[model samples]
Target: MKPRIIMNFALIITLYSALTFYIGWNGWIWLHTAFGLQDKWIFGVILELISFSYIIGHFLKGIPFFKVIGAYWFGLLQYAILFLPLANLIALVLIYLNLPTTTIVKWVGAFVLAAFIVLFLYGSFNAYSPVVRKYSLAIPKNAGKLTKLRIAMASDMHFGRLSGISHARRLVREVNALKPDLILMPGDIIDDDPEPFIQKNFGDVMKDLSAPLGVFGVLGNHEYYGGGIPRYLTEMNRIGITILLDQVTNIADSFYLVGRKDKTDRDRMPIEDLLMNTEINLPIIMMDHQPAELKQAEKNHVDLLLSGHTHRGQMAPNHLITKRMFEVDWGYLKKNQLHTIVSSGFGFWGPPLRIGSRSEIIQIDVTFV
Candidate 1:
């Protein structure tokens, strides 16, 4: 592992461990005082077990049954991590006012547990079910002979324990239901673990996706993090999904579609280089993963840019991070002739949950003026 990766993992593990410990301590106190539960140590052990399972799950992707169990546990851990803080804060407020903490603790504990249960349950279903987010863009009058084009696009379908063949089938079904002339995937198709995809035979279902103009995709950060670019490329190719790494193609005799590799590539080609040989007069629709470098795309006279990676914060308060990080984190942004659409993503990366953002597929109705 790279030093940076090792350091990041160490930092995450340390922080997660601290949070787990805090929640367990507070929870035990609540159980002991409010409900007279004598098994505080047992509860602590259970929390430890859950944490361990999550930590090891990252390494157990190749394992069969353990991976599934670990994944579910990891999902639970994600919810707990978020809920515990709020629960603890509530207890703190009661104590701060010098009120009766024991009674309040019970109410807080019960409320936290119930709320998390509902949140995770809803999030699971939500993550599995993606809604179509449609947009309409007009091609400049100077470009293209094609009058109208229907493009169905999605991104961040992190296929693994949380999202596998079943989720893949649903997305493919929805995309096909749209009867689009073209299909585009911005990136993060595979999660960090590619083993689960192999175990689930996800490609078999994905192969059924129908787009007459063909399905094309760019590389996402996860594609490199997942550690199997060639394997993913081969699998996508087997399913007839074209993986375009900083390449441009003209389709439908009307527009140019350009796909760029994720910024993870240290030597990634620039937009200028990718479009250098292409006909600039045609309407160019670019699919780049992170949504950075808009000026470059605009400079190259890119008519439309489709991207996904942010997941629009995926959870509350996190959206604040993405909003500040990217120039166009979510939704549509147009500057003169250059247009951009960034999807919150069709699937999730972790927790199998979305607290603030909705998973979405972009149904773009492009009219060549």
Candidate 2:
């Protein structure tokens, strides 16, 4: 790695370690005073293990228990980082007011616990409950004899250990119910590892997803991280779903469905180059996993662009960052003649919790003139 890359990585590690230490220290103080616990070594060890469990589980794929613990810890860690300092500040104020130590601890602890519980409950509901977000738009170009097309799209399914068989079944049931003429998945179809998806037989559940115009998908960054593109493609094809990697297909001579390699792929073709051979006269619908290149799609005359991968930050306040990161982070955006629709995603990444965003599927009704 380059010197700058190494430096940045080191900085991230240092920051994570410092934050984890802060959280652990506060937690230890709470336990010691509130519950009369004095075993500092045990607390420190456990905290460290939990803090790094996600990394451990990621590399050692055999140990799923660590991943589960780590996933929940991550959700807690985010809120803890946000609220813990405030709790500490409040405690300091209480001390200045000459409040009893026990009373101060009790009040702060109770408030923090209640806040965390409410966030977890609400966030869990938002993560698990998938909603259909509908969009109706018109294209000036004609698509053969077809005047309208109903496209059902779900991106960032991230099906793995966290989002298992139940989520897969729910997705299949939901999309099939929509009875869309076409189904498009803009990616992150599986979590980092494809083993869990295959081992748990999620393919069987997903194979039930039905659409007459067929189901198509492109890879997200996560797919590249997993490095199981060939296997993922094979499994998806087996289930009648096509994983299109920088490829285009004409759909019944009506419209073109273009799927691009993720932005993460260094060799990913440019929009103009990818469409060079294609007949642009037809209504062209394209899927690029991340909504980072809307201008390129619009400039290339892509009629409709589908994407996800934002998750709209997945948690609150985080959406603010994503909003600035991507032009259209969560919903629809009209850039000139191009119609871009980006879903918040049907699944999540780290924690199966969503604060500001809900798991969603996009149902787009396209009318071609």
Candidate 3:
């Protein structure tokens, strides 16, 4: 590499390393602060170092969205960060000098600023993740055939302390409130090893979820990496979300819900088998995580497909990548024989930072005349 280019590459690596560590460790810091953790001095911190391996693995797998974020906003964020440490020091000094000021007022100001930052980040990520993303279609209704088909869609539940029981119950309640005849979980149900929560009372949190027809989920790329597919599958089964691996199912006597495995699966998804099994007369709806398989979905004349892997690129300016990589990025679109709706999702997986995409639950109302 040329001298300047080499230096720039070095600088980029340094930044990536620093931020990944911070992202990894921030969870540890929160755990300590939240419950007054009394473990080994460095237990949480060590886990942070280990978690960076996933960062390295993600880069190896060619996560392209980060490049997009760097191209657009890295310059501005870097500029802000240059002054951030100094700003913190200056604030501390001011607080110390104004010791006569009320401690309550200062503490309240600090908390208010922190809450604003959290809210700002959350709202910026706001995409329409409706528990019922309503839509209409015309199908023939028999004397006693299925009239209205309901679909409940959810994604990106990180499943740590924050994403545990309470979060799942609330989202599931929101979804069940729509009374979906069918349910779909696109991917990333349990962010990492759901084992910690699953073993405790947390697993019961998901049991309250009920769908008249059934609930099905696919392996997100995270499930494969975090602890392996079977581990995630075990947890889901315990909670009763059926695992669909390159499988297709007929829904409500008119439509087909075919869930393809995540693109990360090297075993080769049996798209042809799925098509062969389903009735050609009925409209087909597919659930594939990446939205990377447009040609096949188009060729198959699928009526609609739902996915949530993009999280609308999961961060700001990065959502542009979802547009570039897939014909449909993070919302509803149709072409040729395909109608696809991509949900930005209901939970944050990594940094608790959602910049460009809204956290959501998608509801698609399928109808027969």
Best by TM-score: 2
Candidates in descending lDDT order = 2, 1, 3
Give residue 104's error in model 2 in angstroms: 0.6
**Residue 130 displacement in candidate 2 (angstroms):** 1.0
**Model 2, 207-283: lDDT tens per residue?**
88888899899999999999898898889888999988899999999999999999999999999999999887998
User: How well does model 1 score by local distance difference test?
Assistant: 0.84
Clashing pairs in 3: 125-357, 125-358, 126-358, 127-358, 129-360, 129-361, 130-361, 132-363, 133-363, 345-360
- At residue 161, give the lDDT of candidate 2: 88
Q: What TM-score, over all chains together, does every model reach?
A: 0.89, 0.98, 0.68
The residue ranges of model 3 lying beyond 4 angstroms of the native Cα positions read 1-12, 15-132, 138-144
Give per-residue CA lDDT, model 1, range 1-369, as digits (tens): 899999999999899788778767877877888778897678887878766775566666554454555556656666677778777777888889998877788888888878878887787777777889889888864544578889999999998777767789898899999999999999999886566676689989888889889999999999999788988888889989999988888786777889898999998898888888887788899999999988898899999999999999886668899999999999999988899999999888766778778888899998877
Model 1 misplaced stretches (Cα beyond 4 Å): 1-14, 34-36, 64-102, 141-145
- Which of the two candidates, 2 or 3, achieves a greater lDDT against the reference? 2
